[model samples]
Target: MIFLLLSIICSVTVGVLLKLAKRYQINVMQAVTWNYLFAIGLSLFFFKPDFSSVSFSLISPVYIALGILLPIIFLFQGFAVRQAGLAKTDIAQRLSLLISLCAAYFIFNENFDRLKYVGIIFGFVAIVLTMYKKQTSSNNKYSWLYLLLVFAGFGVIDILFKLVSQLNEIPYTTALFVIFCISFVLSLAYILYLAIAKKTKIQLINFVCGCILGLFNFGNILFYLKAHRAMAENPSTVFAAMNIGVIIIGSLIGILVFKERLSKWNYTGLVFALIAIVLITLSKLHAV
Candidate 1:
């Protein structure tokens, strides 16, 4: 539980820092690359895992493909955040939980009660509402296409996590290392493209941003792994608490600290999202 909370804090902090990085014109792709590099290194320190333990014979190509998609998602996420702003982008991304839930239901046969249904409904409403854009002289309206893509991309990523978790007896540390390797390779390719195109230069700011991002990125996975481990001990409470708590905390920081704005429709959407969250919480408590 402690780890999960720390992970949530780190996750929110990443969003804040990413937003700040825009001012430095940091190379988000390179930062993402370095983040994976650091994550791989960190996993090694914790797991001291042997390469022999990695059973290539048992691994699925589809599962490995999913791992590769993570960095691509990060690439899209950077654009989404830049274009849509923090609050809207995050709301869209979080709504991808619907995709994960459906995948869990069918693939993992995860069962839920009536309250979960209500929660899903509210979550859907929140997604729509949060995407509502108000025309302002100062700010460009949120792009619906960008929001949709962000949601879909992250939705698939979330489902991939569940799929990978179920596929092998791989330690979480090992799993992360594999994911980092895949993402790092892809990110390197992306950086090379940028360099060749002369779109931007990788400078000290990019490296510094990457270093900071790496710490949070590594912590995010570690804490998320801890959350899952904790869920094994107390499923309903831990899962519900972690998800809703992170969203609430992230949303609060986005709005108050960052002064991210939403239109009237967004407020309504947030209400629904909150209601959905409440339903999930209630369901968990009932199970307890």
Candidate 2:
């Protein structure tokens, strides 16, 4: 429970940090590209994943896919947060939880009862609430498109991680470490391209921002891995907690810290989203 809570907190703070980074004039791709470089170091030190046990034939393809997907997802998320702000962006991203759950059910043969079904419906409601727009202007009109891309990218990333975990036949820690290594190599390639193209100046502060993002990201994933392992028997419940908790906490922080505001209708939608979260928690507790 404690690990689950901690993971949620870290996940929520990540958004706040990334949004703050934008205020520092950091471009999305540059910030995320450097983030992966630093993430490689932390993943190595903490997980220390050994490739010796992995069957190359089975894990190689998944690793490659993960390598490609990660940077794309991170880039999309950074753009989404930049355009939509953290509150709505996070709400959109949280929809991936439902996508992942559905994939796990049909593809992985996970089971859920009637109450869980109710929770899933609530989650869908939250998604609708998230996609709702409070104000529409020329600039912000297309914001939903960006957020949707973030949702799609995040869903694909989640499914890829699950597939990699299954194929590698290793703990989530090692699988994450492998993914990070591959992603690091890819990010380095991107950094080199940026350097050659002179797209933007890579300042020390940019690298430092990436390092900070990497550290928090490592902690977020680490706590999540621990929570998942500890609650392996109730993985769905943990997912439920983490997803809704991240949205609520993250949204609150965006409002309080960043002064994000929603319309009256969107505020009502936020209430529904909160109710959905309660339903999810109640369903999980009852299942237990």
Candidate 3:
């Protein structure tokens, strides 16, 4: 439970930090690039993944795809947090499980029960409602697009990671390390391109911010994995609690601390999101 709680806090804190980045005028790309550096270091230290026996020929394509996608999705997440409020961004991200569920049904040939179908329906409704923003001349008028990208991007990443997990050639942890290393190299290259083409100076502040962001980002993964190990017999409990906890906590922080306003429809959407998660969890439990 402690690991679960820490994971939730770390997940929400990543959003909070991204939110703060905008206010501080930090370059998100630089911060994100530096984030991968720290994440790579952390992965090496804790997981100590052995890649000597890894078969790059077999997993290179999947590894490369994930390598490219992780940093890109992370950048999208930062943009979404800046354009959309934390509440909406977090909801969209969490609800991305719907995409994974669909893939399971269609691609993986997994069966779903009535409750899961109902949950999927409510999840779609929640997305539409929560993303509704009143007409405003503000620059954030198109923020909903960023929210959508965040939702879809994460969903795709989830699918790819699931694919990686199905592989027998390499351990998941080792695959994670390789992916992170690749992400770092790619992100660094982009940062270098910006420096040369756009004359964007690599600032110390961005590095500092990136390191902090990486700490929370890695912590989120670390604690979530820890929670899973701690409750190996009750995986559903960790899944349900982590998702529900992030939504509730993120909404509160966005509304109260950040003063983000939500419409009545948005509030309704949030309620429905919780219901959707509960239904999905129940469906999983019933399946077991």
Candidate 1 vs 3: which has more TM-score: 3
For residues 1-288, what per-residue lDDT tens digits would candidate 1 score against the true structure? 788788778777777677776777777888888877777788788767667767777556645776678777776767766666667666677678778777767877878899988888889888878877766643445466677888899888877776666666676456657777777887878788888897767776777788788889778777877787876766656655655665677677778877877678987876787677679778767766
C-alpha lDDT score of every prediction, in listed order? 0.74, 0.76, 0.92
**Candidate 2's residue-wise lDDT over 27-76, tens digit each?**
65666767777877887787777767655554567778888888887777
Q: Each candidate's root-mean-square deviation in Å?
A: 2.4, 2.5, 1.1
Task: Please write out the lDDT profile of model 3 over residues 58-154, one tens digit for every residue.
Answer: 5668789999998898888888888888999999999888899999999999999999999999999999999998868778887899899989998
Which residue ranges in model 1 land beyond 4 Å of their true spot? 136-142, 284-288
Structural similarity to truth (TM-score) of each candidate: 0.89, 0.88, 0.97
Task: Name the regions of candidate 2 deviating beyond 4 angstroms.
Answer: 54-58, 168-171, 230-237, 281-288
Q: Which candidate is the best by TM-score?
A: 3
Worst 10 residues of 2 by lDDT: 51-60
Q: Rank the candidates by TM-score, best first.
A: 3, 1, 2
Output the lDDT of residue 23, model 2. 86
